[model samples]
Target: MNVVITPHTLQGTVEAPSSKSIGHRDLICAALADGESVVDNISPSQDIEATCQILQAFGADIQEIPSSHPGRAAYCVRGGLKRQDQPLSVNANESGSTLRFLIPVGILSGNTVTFHGQGRLAKRPLAPYYTIFDEKHIAYTTTDGALPLTVHGTLRPGRYALAGDVSSQFFTGLLMTLPLLSGDSHLQSTTPLESASYVNMTIDCLTQHGIQIDKDWNGSYHIPGNQQYRNGEYVVEGDYSQAAFWLSAGTLGKAICCTGLRPHSSQGDEVIVSIIRQMGGQIEGKTELTACPSLLEGRVIDVEDCPDLVPVLTVLATCSKGITRIINAGRVRLKECDRLHAIATELNKLGADVEEEPEGLIIHGVSGLTGGRVSGWNDHRIAMALAVASQRCSGTLVIEGAECVRKSYPEFWQDFASLGGIYRQED
Candidate 1:
């Protein structure tokens, strides 16, 4: 899909979409609980759907509960799965998060689980899990360290040590699955975990569902076996990551206040508001954020833990004064696209001084940016970030493959248009 956007003044309030991070965790926990789990305010994204589908295949009775309002509908994934001894074939599609989070938990079923993924997932690395399984003597094999892995796991509770620098999702999978093991399990990390905040989110969700995990600052996790999940209604909070685009656009236009966000959100992207504040943008209220019209100026932004922010932050970086360095986000290369490279490439096309690094990006602020045709890299974040970038740039910005934003925020373009975003298609 093609999308073009010209500078427009955003002067309205919009409700942010629910966070998929919290929603995915809540879904898995709810599925493992004894009673029905009603997940409210879910972002009907492809990634979240992949998660729900996996839970249903595990014997959870999932149903879409009709909503009376125009907002998101509630979903109930019934617990108490009737055990099926047959082999299970699960598709992770393009969501690497799902494959990592669910594969370990699926092992507890004692049924052979075969994973099939599409596109990038087919080439994405699963070497970390493969190595751990080998060390534990668990039966597992993969297709060249990628997806289509078959694991006939006789999950035995024991000490498993894994490197934490690779991806937090691997550790998250184990943390969520270990508690359900038949025996007490101990997980020791060989390195300090990267994205530690995400691990905390997992711990929070596990605790909410009645799973007891003992953790020390030294990176050891102890799981008490035979614990059960408690069923209840869980509300997914607004996505700070998705809200960053609108919030940034507000800075370029009139005050844009966003609702439906929590003051204390567990999402890593919640740092957007704080980052904006540090960059000299006036921000007010958590639920109703108002960005003051001001020039975005900054020296550096360390987005190591929040790689998802790189694309959107890059857009903000372009409008800032001085230089902006987004560091420690090398893992972004492994995302849906090489986001660091993609953002830099697109920004450079828009007449901005941008440089890409192995681990991050360096951006020298330009007095103004002249928009031109650019590529979205078929990544949702890239698509949305560029849309925000267009709001502040001169001339029209034409984005190829811009429809990719539907993967996360389906109504992004519509919302942008509703907020006075102006553009006309070339085709």
Candidate 2:
């Protein structure tokens, strides 16, 4: 789908969607629990659905219940890691979290489990798991380092060493599976851990499900054997990653009020609030965030911990004064899209001065943007970033593949329209 956005000021309120990161972790724990678990405040999206469907295929009974709140659904998951007798082939469908989180669970089955994925997901790194699998002499095969991999071996619980700089999803994968092992396991990080907030988020989910993990002062994790996941109710908090888009619009437009965000979330992307303020965007309210246009100034930001914020942050940088340097964002190139390149290229096409670097972006802020045609790069964040950029455009901004926002924020276009953003769909 394509969309044409006319330059207009945006204002009004929109509730943020549930955090996809938290939703994935909660659903995985709920599926592994001893009894039924209720997960509330979930908004259905492609990534969340991928996790739920994969859990179902792993023999967890899941039922979705309608909630009184619009765009929210409750899930009752009868938890277990029961493996079916039939040949097990799981399709991750471009969800990196689903594929990474479930690989260790598949190893626990002691059966040959085949995993497949689409899009750039197949190209994402999985070396962290392979290193351990090799050290433990577990049998596995892959299409090089990508997906369409198969693993057949009993995971022996012991010391599993992983690189800290790699994707934290690997650490999370092991953390989720180690508790299920018959013997205790120690996860040692070979280096300083980046994206540690995600690990904390996983730990938070595990603790909620009655699983306890000890963290060493040196940053290693100690998992006890024979742990059980207890069934309970979990409410997913609003996503700061998705909210970054609307809040970014506030920096460039009139005002944007976003509700449903937790003031103290472990999500790394919550730094968007602070970063916006650092760039001179006015933010007010507590639970309900209100961002208004201010005398925007450029500042340097390290994205090693919050790679997901790069796209929207780049958009904010474009409308600011002086130079905004986004560093430590090399990992963003491996996301659903090459976010650094995509953001630099797409926004530059709209007459913004953005320079792409090997690991980050150097953006020189301009007074305004001259809009033109751009591609969404088949990425949800990129699509939304372009939509928000349109608020400051001097001409109509046409974005191809705008429907890609369904991956994490299906109602993004609707929310954009609700904020008085003027746009029309183009076939």
Candidate 3:
């Protein structure tokens, strides 16, 4: 789908979408637990939906409960894996996080699992996982270190050390799988873990489900094997990552109010609020959830661990008064799209001085953007980021391939329209 976003000042309030980062962990935890578990406030996005489907394929009983009232739904998930009637062929689609988190968990069930993904995911690297599997004595095969991987193993619990720089999904995979293993497990990191906030989210979900993973002084994860997860209720929090788009839109328009996010969230994207505030955006309301426009001073930010924010932050950079530098984001190039290049290329098309560096980007802010057609690279973040950037543009910004936002935020366009932003569907 292509989206035509005209220049408009946004107003009103909209709750942020549920965090897939937390929701994915909650679902995995529920699937690992015994008995029935209720997960509330979860989203129906494609990424989380893929995870739910995969867990069901491995024998988890999931029921979608409808509410008598409007806008209410919950999932009842019965945990523990049972062998499928046929060989399991898992289609991960385009969600990298789903593929990485589920693959190792699937390995623990001793099922002959065949994994597949589309587009860039097919070419994305899984070399680190292959090496980890080899070291752990897990049986696995990959086609030239890419997806279409096959793994068959019970994932025996043991001591393992993994690098923390490349991606947190690797560690999240192992951390989630260890409890189901045969023996106690220990994981030590070689470097100061990047994206440590995400690891905290994983640990938080595991703890809520009655699973214990002790963190040592050195930040090693100590998991006692054979500990089953306790089934209960989980309410997913709002996604600060998705909020970045609306927050950006608001900053460029009339003061907008955002709800559904906690101020003290473990999410790294929460830092975006402070970053925006420093850039001269004023936030009002002394409540857990509220955001308003503030001054935007273009400045440099290091997003080494929170690479997902690069797109929206880059959009905010376009509206700043001076040059804004985004550094420590080399890993973003390996995501759904080459985000660094995508940000630079799209921003440049809108008449912004954006320089794509080897590690980050340099954006020289201007009075206003001169809008033109831009590609979304079939990346959800890029799609939403461009839409937000269009708010202060001189003309309509046509975002080709904007439908990619459905992977995480299905209601992005509708929500934007509700907030007084104009979104017309253009073929």
Q: For residues 1-427, could you state the per-residue lDDT of candidate 2 as single tens digits?
A: 8998998988999999999999999999998887888999998899889888878887789999876567798999998877677768888898999999999887775557888888999888999989988999989888778888988778878999989887899999899989988999999989888899999989988998899999998889999999999899889999999999988888788888999999988888899999998887799987899998888899999999999999989988888889999999998998998999999999999889999999999999988888799999999999998888898898999999998999888998888889998999985
lDDT of 3 by residue, 155-182 (tens): 7777888788778888888888888776
TM-score of each: 0.96, 0.98, 0.96
TM-score of 3: 0.96
Candidate with the greatest TM-score versus the true structure = 2
Candidate 3 lDDT: 0.84
Output the lDDT of residue 62, model 3: 88
Between prediction 1 and prediction 2, which has the larger TM-score?
2
RMSD of 1: 1.6
On the 0 to 100 scale, the lDDT of residue 394 in model 1 is: 79
Between candidates 2 and 3, the TM-score winner: 2
Candidate models: Cα lDDT each = 0.83, 0.89, 0.84
Rank the models by lDDT, top first.
Answer: 2, 3, 1
Q: By TM-score, highest first, what's the ranking?
A: 2, 3, 1
Q: Write model 1 residue lDDT over 264-295, tens digit each, in one string.
A: 76777888898998898878886888776778
